[model samples]
Structures are given as structure tokens and as C-alpha cells.
Target: MFKPIKSLAFATLGLAIAAPVMAEEVNLYSYRQPELLKPLTDAFEAETGIDVNVAYLSKGMVERLTAEGKRSPADLVLTVDISRLSAVVEAGLTQPVQSDVLTANVPAAYHDPDGQWWGLTTRARVVYASKDRVKPGEVTTYEDLADPKWKGRICTRSGTHAYNVALTAAVIHHLGEDGAKQWLEGVKANLARKPQGNDRAQVKAIWAGECDIAIGNTYYMGKMLEDPEQKAWADSVNIVFPVFEGGGAHVNISGVALTKSAPNKENALKLMEFLTSPKAQQIYAEANHEYPIAPGSEPGELVKSWGSFTADDVNLMELAKLRPAALRIIEEVDFDG
Candidate 1:
């Protein structure tokens, strides 16, 4: 029988290793940086007395897990981006996790139907426009970026990057294949410079007056403001949550999954449930400056200051299915060129 998660009396921890593993422990292979996860790992250890050993991987998580096979020690996998989570699932690296606590705490839209992965938080892919130049109503939707009225005024990373690909895929879902392709070509023709660099770089380009607007994830605004050198870049733009013509803003998630090879399945499930609990939700929201997956959990002050927008409810699995098509469209448009 499944159990309901009853209490969330977690004390904020300084989050260093609580103690050495003695009785029980769970191993984690995470694509998320250690700094972002330290607080959650600390709290889980405090609440359940289970030691969490996390291996932070910058890339190649699937390859590493596959190469290790069933001999692997990874009990849980944590990563940012739905596509990465989907990649792990496609590679047969994770297993289905059916838990009462999980279904109760996470909305069905944010978790896998088969329970292969559960989204922990969502980051909106929004437009950052020059506060001095682009007026409040100048740009309103993701589709608006393609208008010839804004030609030579947009900055972005390469179209093939996971973030853009996912956004492009959503457009494909709403529009037909031909519509998605035209939007890609339209936005590509409006580029300020050949797509180069990451989201933060796009904001810097906006700050430098290289372009009047740029497309980037919402959380990057919080990150830039924290860096003394990038504060000016952060100050130069107004965050705009752009919607699709008939839908809400495009959003993506950082998710967790149970590895097929998990040795400590019960303990791993405990940690996963704890992560979606209100207590752990706040810690992750505050740390990453993202929207919590758990209802009633609020985002950090800085993130709140940016205002909010409705998120599209298109199934993430649908977006995952469109990744290859999105990439094909990107290639067809010669977007980076």
C-alpha cells in the first residue's frame, strides 16, 4: 500500500555533509549543479537520516549510466530541461515510480504519465526587451518576434540549443509543420547577429544596444542581477512573458526520475517525495529562482518582482516527441547562419 506524506517539519540547514553514511544511503546522478541541490540534500538527510551521495555531471549522464549498466549505483537522476529527462527515459535509464505522495503533490501536467520522471520546477522562456527602447506594448507574443517591423532587432542563442528547440517544438504542436517552419524563418531573418552564446549573452547583447530585444529564460534575469558585473545588463531590460497566439507562455522544467538500476528504491522514493513537498519546494524555488511544481509554494522575491504569466498546458511528452522535428526545422532554416 502507498503512504501519504504527512509532515514537512524541515529545519533550514547550512547543508554540509550531515554525517557519514552508516545505516541507509541513496546515490544520485545529477545534471543540476551541486550548489543548487545542497539545501535539498541537507534537508532530506535531516528529516529521514538517509545519506545522499550525489555525482554532479555537466554532460553525458545517459552515456555514463548506460556504460555502467545494472552495476550502476545511481538511485535517482536529477536534471534541468524536459528534453534531458526525456533522453534518459528514451535510453531506458529510468524506471516508473508510482507513489501516492508524488501524484498528490505534483500536477499531472508536470509529471510523466508512466511515472518515469517528475518535474520539480518550471522556467519560462520569455523575451527580454530594452527598457529604454522597446515600449511596454511593443512586443507581446513569441510569434511577434518574427514580424518585419522588428527586423534586425532580436538577439538569441543558436536555434538548435535545447531551450529554443523545445520552444520551437511547442509552436509546431500549436501550428502545423509548415507554420512552425515559417515562424523559424521569420525569426531567423530578424536576427541582430548570427546566433552565438547563451541566454545571458543575449541579455548582454541587449544591454550593449546590439539588439533591442532578446529571448531568454526568466531565471537568467535573477542570476544576472546577482553578479556584480552583470547587474547593468540585468538593469537594461524589462522581462516580458510572451504567450503564443492562442496559448500561454512557453515553459520548461527541471525534473527527477528513479533510475532503473536503483538499489535503494524505497529511500530514493522518499527523497523524491520530499523534493516535491512544500518545504523542499521553497528551498529549490528560492535557490534556483524558479516556479515550484508543488501548489501553494511561492517563488523567491526577485522572481515574483518579474510578474507572472499563464503557462501552456501542452503535455511535455508531446514537446519531447517533437525534439527531432524541431531540430530538423532548425537545420532547414540555417538559423545560426
Candidate 2:
């Protein structure tokens, strides 16, 4: 009788042990599409056996997090670009995270000065040109896009786009707002067609002969080259590394941060550290065709193929600080109109 009782006690204790293990989970709020992020999420889950629950939305994540407030169940926030990250920080939705791995991997320029966020990967603002229409040597600098010679031959996404907006902000940092405005207006005047579509669409427009030049993030070119449906767009254009004469190529980041009211603070910190680890950095670069934040880590084949170019290295937060001004200038110039 005592042996049966002992066996039952053991089973009960086993279940109690498993309960906490099963409860070891982390919730994530991400602006990245699920398909694009699955690989990294899967790796994290496999490595730590920590179940990850993710809510993926293309927009309104900041507003949602703000609304959730201290009652929010989110532990981590992941998104693209410093502007959105800065918005989250400005809204007080994120809190300081002091992970040595993160600080070591992500350069100071690519992270929040107050430790609210850290960049994981980066994309370059590069040019794509019509292979048959434009010569490489003829277009070497972003300032050249403003020259009258390239007039009536350029294509780009709407200036309101965060990528273009950030690039414009970088320009403003290098040139005063007044000079940046003139450059923006000149580029707008040179548009071969009304600014429309994402970066890939700009490439498609070039393929259709609507324009001879387009500005886009480098990863989009890799995506187009890999997707069968987008092959024609890739084949029709050649990429150009247009360093701004004084500023170098503008770059943007995909970043992560801890939520202000995270219930799983310890777990969230672990995740942040894991993300910046060399292994995770490799995953970021390989899966996303983005440059790793960790120095000396290889940037995957697609990014490596683009060759090395100088990055502007402007403090990304400065881009955020200038966001309102940039948007105002974009509007005042009637960029979309």
C-alpha cells in the first residue's frame, strides 16, 4: 500500500515540475511579417525551449502597446527602422535594457542612447538603375540625382516612406535643412513617374521603362533576385552604391527592445542577449540579407555580393529627432503631390 502511495506522490511531483517548464514562455509584439520572422523565432524556441507567442502587425503596434500600458502582456517589441523604434521610446512604451551582448554587438550609433532599443540588423539605402539606360560611373553620388542631367529619369517610393524619410533625415544631418529641402525638391522634379509602390515596385517600374533610376534598400534587390516572379525586375536593373558626397550611404535598422511593463523581464533580457550573440547575429544576416550588428560577422551572400561601401554612421536617434522636421519638409515640398 505504501509503495502505491509513493508512486502516486512521484507522479504528482513530476507534474508540478513540468508545470513551470510549460509556463516558460515569452510574448512578442512584432511589426515584421510572420513569414519573414519564422526562422529566427523557430531557432530561439529550439535553443531555449521557451515558447514564443507573437502578435505580428504591419502597423499600429506602437498605439496598441501604448494602449496596453502597464497591463500589457507584451515582453518584447521588434520592428524595422529607427523612427518607429524612437516613436515607441518617445511614447514611453519601452524601458532601458542593459544587456552586455547587445551593447557589444550593436554599435552606439545604431542604438538608443538611453538603452531603450538596440539595432539587430541594417539595410543600406542604395540605387537601382536601368541597365540599358544608365552607366555606373555616371551616377556615383546621391547628390547627382538632383542634377538636371538625370531629370525626368528617376523613380522612388513616396517620400513619406520611412526608408526615404530616414534617408532624407540623414541628408538633413549632413546638409542643413535648407540644402536638404532643395535636394529633395530637385529629386522630386526629376521623377519619371509619380512616386508609388514599395522598393520592389520602384524596380518593377524601372523594368517597365517608366524610369531609369530608383532608390531602395539593398535587401529588396536580393528578394527580387530570389523570387521567380520578381526576376524580371532584378534583371532589368543594375544596383549602384551612391555614397552621398559628404554623408556616405544612408542606412536603417531592424531593432528590438524590452517593453516598459514586461512581466517576464528576466526572460526578455535573455532573449535580447541571445539575439545579439554571434550565432543569432548570423541568423539575422543570413535569413534577412541584412548586415549583422556584430562586427566581423559575415553579412550573408546577397549582402556580401553588393561589395563593401561606407555607411554614414550618423546617430540613428538623430534621424528620429529630425523626423518631424523631415516630414514637414516632405509635406511642404508637396513630395507626394
lDDT of all predictions = 0.87, 0.82
| Tens digits of per-residue lDDT for model 1, 101-179 | 9998899889999999998999999999999999998989988988998899999999999999999999999887899
What are the RMSD figures for all models against the true structure?
Answer: 6.4, 7.8
What candidate 1 gets wrong by more than 4 Å, as runs, is 1-23
Error of 2 at 153 (Å): 0.4
TM-score for each of the candidates: 0.93, 0.92
Rate residue 97 of model 2 by lDDT. 80
Regions more than 4 Å wrong, model 2: 1-23
Clashing pairs in 2: none
- TM-score (C-alpha) between model 2 and the true structure: 0.92
lDDT of 2 by residue, 257-334 (tens): 999877678778878887777788898778888888787777987678778888887889988999988998999999
Model 2 steric clash total: 0
